[model samples]
Target: MARRKFTREQMIAAARDIALHRGAGRVTLEAVAEVIGSTKGAVLHTFPNKLTLLEELLRSMCQEWDRRFDEIQSKTTGDALSAYIETWEQSDPQAPSYLEAVAVARAEDPKLLEPVRQAYQRYGNLMQLDGPIATDALVAWMACEGLVLLDLLGLHRFDQTTKDAFFSRLKAIAAAHNGEGT
Candidate 1:
């Protein structure tokens, strides 16, 4: 049987799956090879080491989110904050946790959080681009972040009705700040 050769994307996805399902501590090269049905040497050839593999996975996840946000922004006539809320609301609740990557990276080296931190800083900057709505937008953004953080940590679950009300209220706030009254 010919061994399946996994692309970089496939390997990173497998590593993320391993981390998300089994806990971040389990994202070893050997484990990834087994998960993807490739050799340990094949995994190493792509990632070189566990830290490198996980770091790339972290970066890839952030980039993917940014890409999705850009796509959302381009498609919606809504303001950035409202679009952000919608994006969060529409995300898959059962998707693999990117937070797992952050946890593992932080444990290995605090510096590994640089990419994550930078992505957030960029998000903050983007939220501030609207002059009139900046403050209210940030409030909405923080509120959305709180909800998302709680969900990500598995600390809270709001029913769809409650979430709809929450997002509607935030959207109204953003609209009001733009002179479009609720």
Candidate 2:
């Protein structure tokens, strides 16, 4: 049988998976290769080393997140703010812990910091909520990030009452912005 032909994107995703679950420093060329049943040579065909691999993964993740927000914005144009809130709450399990590696990259390599900032910028522009609603939107995103991090790090869990309270606050803020009563 011939070796499987994995794209650069595939390798990057595998690297992200390894980094998110195992830890940031664990994203070696050999580890990603094993995840995809490839070889270090194959991974290096796309990335020169672990740093290059991590950089590619971070860039792709950021760009993909931006694209997702764009899609949500277009899909629910009439209620983009609501759509954004829902998407924010429903982010993937891998995302929160994924930030762990990205944060490490901030200090270890210069390339990592920009993607996080860019991703947030894209999300904000797509949200298109103004004034107070924008502030609430930021709060919602921050809360979701906190929830995910807490869960991933085994630190804390947001009880149902707390989660409900957050949703209530966010929805109330959005409702008020839309000229409705929450």
Candidate 3:
């Protein structure tokens, strides 16, 4: 039997998938290599250490969001807000699981701090928002993030009704910001 060689990209993706399934602290070079059919030494050759791998995965996650936000922003026909809303409501699957992992790792590792900060900064940029526009969109984005984290932590349960009301309020905020008098 022969071991597979994973590209830097494949290894990172596998690491992210592992973290999402088992949670961040449990993710290890061995775990990722196992998932990718490679070896711990193989992963180490690519990434100097776990923090290095996690940092890259975290950055890749942010870049993915930047890409997706650009895609959604390009659609200009109907309410961009609606597209934005849907984009985020379904973003976890579309984006990497690294952000959720960051929340989990924040209290201990602290290596995650910079990447998550950079991610949020880029997020504000990608939202195509500035000044007051930035305020509303940032709040909305944070609200979505907080709710998603709460759900992930089993602290908050959102039924369909609550989801609808929250989204409705978000849309109304966007509309108001657009000066449509929502």
Candidate 4:
């Protein structure tokens, strides 16, 4: 029998599937190894420990968000706020899984959240929001965060009609504040 070679990306992807489907708490080295049909050593070689694995997963998620945000910013000729709203509209469905892993990692060690924190801080700076529009931008931003939270926790879902109304209001705010300050 030949030993299967698992690439780092393949291992990470398997870990993500395990975290999302089996639950974040269930994302163990053994679980990942089992999913990838590899030895524990193989998985450990890619990720020294479970914490490292989760941290990489969270970091990748944040990096992906930044990449998408940049893409949105580049394609949009509107204000930063409007670009941000459009970016939010293109939210990744897999975000909740990464968020769940963040929760688990944070519960174990608060320092694990540094990457996520830094990402958000950088995101705020990139938004170029200030002056009169800051308030509206902040409100719209928080609303999007609330929506992500609701989706992640599977607490409550907004029907299409309600979501349409909410997004209409958000778009209005974003459009109104598009080029107010800068």
Candidate 5:
């Protein structure tokens, strides 16, 4: 039989799956190799080290978030804040979240969060509008992030109705700040 071939993306994906399901502490080069049906040497040939693998996982997650944001922004008639909120609203609840990446980063090295921080900084700049309601826009953006954080941390206590109300209110606030409507 021929040797199994695994791409860098496949390695990273296997690491992500391990981190998300088994916890970040469970993700190791050997574990990833096992998941991908390869050898630890094969995994290292691609990642160089466990830290590199974890960093790549976090970077990939950030890149995926940027792609989703851009896709929503392209279709949105409102401002960046609105696009950001809509993107969160449309996210898959069962999908892997930033929390998983964050856990892995925190477990391996705090510096792994740099990609996440940079992504937030870029989004922050995009959400900055030139108007008196800039603060309102900021608040709206914070609220949306807070909602997502709560849900990710499993601290969200609001029922579906309350969550829907919160989203509706957030949309209205974003619209009003954009000078569209309340």
Candidate 6:
């Protein structure tokens, strides 16, 4: 009988699907192997441990965010704050699993979140380029982060109208800080 072959990307994709559908806590080497129709050894070949797998998943998520940020920043004429706000606004708020990667990484090992922290730091540097308005941009970015955290934790009490209004205000603040008016 021929052994099933699974690529590293296939294992990561399986892990991501499990994390997104079942929950990050449910993502394990065995789960990923099963999802990919391969043995645990195959997954282990690429991801030595579950923590490594989760870290890779988290890193990949951050990379995707960076890609989106670049695309949006270009469209916004290099307005980092506006790009950040638009990226958050455009993401699916209902899909809390996107943030679940952070929770999983923290649970496994706080240091595993280095990729996430690095991504944020990169964005923070860009926000600082606004010079005098950097403070306002930082404030807007902080607000967006807080809102996302609240939503991810299911602690937000905002109705659809309130959520829309909040995001509208966030966009207004970003625009104002970027010198595009409210």
lDDT of each: 0.76, 0.68, 0.70, 0.73, 0.82, 0.78
Better of 2 and 4 by lDDT: 4
Clashing pairs in 1: none
Please give each candidate's TM-score.
0.86, 0.75, 0.78, 0.86, 0.88, 0.85
| Per-residue alpha-carbon lDDT of candidate 3 for residues 93-120, written as tens digits (9 for 90 to 100) | 4356445657535633886778677766
Top candidate when judged by TM-score against the true structure: 5
Residue 164's lDDT in candidate 5: 82
10 residues in a row with least lDDT, candidate 1:
93-102
- For residues 1-182, write the lDDT of model 2, one tens digit per residue: 89889999788778778767787667789998999999889888888887777777777766665566557656763455565565555666566333554554764576677768776676566556566556766666566667767876668867778877876677666566555663
Clashes per candidate (backbone, < 3 Å): 0, 0, 0, 0, 0, 0
* lDDT (tens digit, per residue) of candidate 5 on 3-66: 9789999998898889867878889999999999989999999989998888888888777777
Question: Which clashing pairs does model 3 show?
Answer: none
Task: Estimate candidate 1's alpha-carbon lDDT, on a 0 to 1 scale.
Answer: 0.76
- Tens digits of lDDT, candidate 1, 1-182: 77677899999888878766786778789988999988999999998888898789888877777676778878876456666767776777544333544666766677888888887778777665467557787788788878977876678989999999999898888677556784
CA RMSD for every model? 2.4, 3.3, 3.3, 2.6, 2.1, 2.6
Q: Over all chains combined, what TM-score does candidate 6 have?
A: 0.85
Comparing 2 with 4 on TM-score, the higher-scoring candidate is: 4
**How far off is residue 35 in model 1, in Å?**
1.2
In model 2, which range of ten residues has the least summed lDDT? 95-104
State the weakest 10-residue window (summed lDDT) of model 3: 76-85
Cα displacement (Å) at residue 107, model 4: 3.9
lDDT of 4 by residue, 85-181 (tens): 6666766667533356566566557888887777667767765668776888889877877876687668888877887788778878877677533
